[model samples]
Target: MTDGMTYRERARTAAHPTGRVASSPVVRHALGRAHGAVPDPVTVFDDETPAVANLDPELLRALRRAATDAADDGVEFFVNGGWRSPEYQEQLLRGAVSKYGSEEEAARWVATPETSAHVLGDAVDIGRLDARAWLSEHGARYGLCQIYRNEPWHYELRPDAVENGCPPMYPDPSHDPRMRR
Candidate 1:
């Protein structure tokens, strides 16, 4: 009824390839459950600078452009999350499930670590009421698309959107078939 590995080891193994997880000591040290230290939030963008490290570099350029435009319109964009490790993602899922009190309800907000776009370094969670509102109107011009109607804060780069505009949003993460694992 028990594997030899500790809970942290089991969670890590189930979340991603063991060797891959082992190689990222920063991720392990920051995301592992055993005495893990939550790393300081990286500043991907701020009033003075537009920097995007440890996130999807391809998406950053477009995001920076959009953020700049939003600023010009008196809306400040802030990145609250990006490029989470699978372990960190699993932790988030557990927290969401606990708060929502059901797997089905939690699935509407969070994806399994294996299916998470953040785990792949391709998604971002933005903050600021004005920013989210502005992005909703103009983000498609920069290829930034809000994938979930429920999570107005979440956005991903969709190159085609620069010309064609973002496709209609899914109602929530649960409605996205990619989240079914």
Candidate 2:
């Protein structure tokens, strides 16, 4: 019984949107380059820009093949997430800190950019709510798996989990007893 925004339910406030500055000239100037000024302070998430958010062609090919296999087996799935930037992740962490408390407090809910699989441009989240439960039975054949203890909607490819396995959005766990298990 999953509802929309399953992960959004954990956060007390809304995270800043990713495409707020979609197609801004400032982003174009700096993309692929190591350094440049950005029009907005927020980092864009994967798929924010067609070029920056694209997946590796080889990986995409495998994903398509797996998807085709699943479809033949009567399962419906799609790659739902792609690349994310450090700046965007920082913005998310800031939001989490605003709601939670410290950087460590954020990790419990969101990942840190350094550790995120999304930044690597290979991980993706795929899920199905159908009763046949195709994803549960077949997604590994494609190299995707859910990540984190809190967000089921999040998935990635770990050598162990993908057929396999965020921005570092959200706050880490808090030192306060009230925030931790």
TM per model? Answer: 0.73, 0.50
* Residue ranges of candidate 2 with Cα displaced over 4 Å: 1-53, 73-75, 78-80, 127-133, 158-181
Choose the strongest candidate by TM-score. Answer: 1
Q: Put down candidate 2 lDDT per residue, 29-104, tens digits, no spaces.
A: 2244222112332111222443233444434444444444554555444333444565655666688877778766
How many backbone overlaps does candidate 2 show? 19
Off by over 4 Å in 1: 1-43, 46-52
TM-score, cand. 1 vs. native: 0.73
Error of 1 at 91 (Å): 0.7
Please write out the lDDT profile of model 1 over residues 33-152, one tens digit for every residue. 222212433223421111124446557667766655555566656677776667777888999999999989999998888998887768888877787889889989989999999999
Model 1 residue pairs with clashes: none
- Give Cα-based local distance difference scores for all models: 0.67, 0.42
Q: How much lDDT does candidate 1 score?
A: 0.67
Question: Cα RMSDs of all predictions?
Answer: 13.4, 13.0
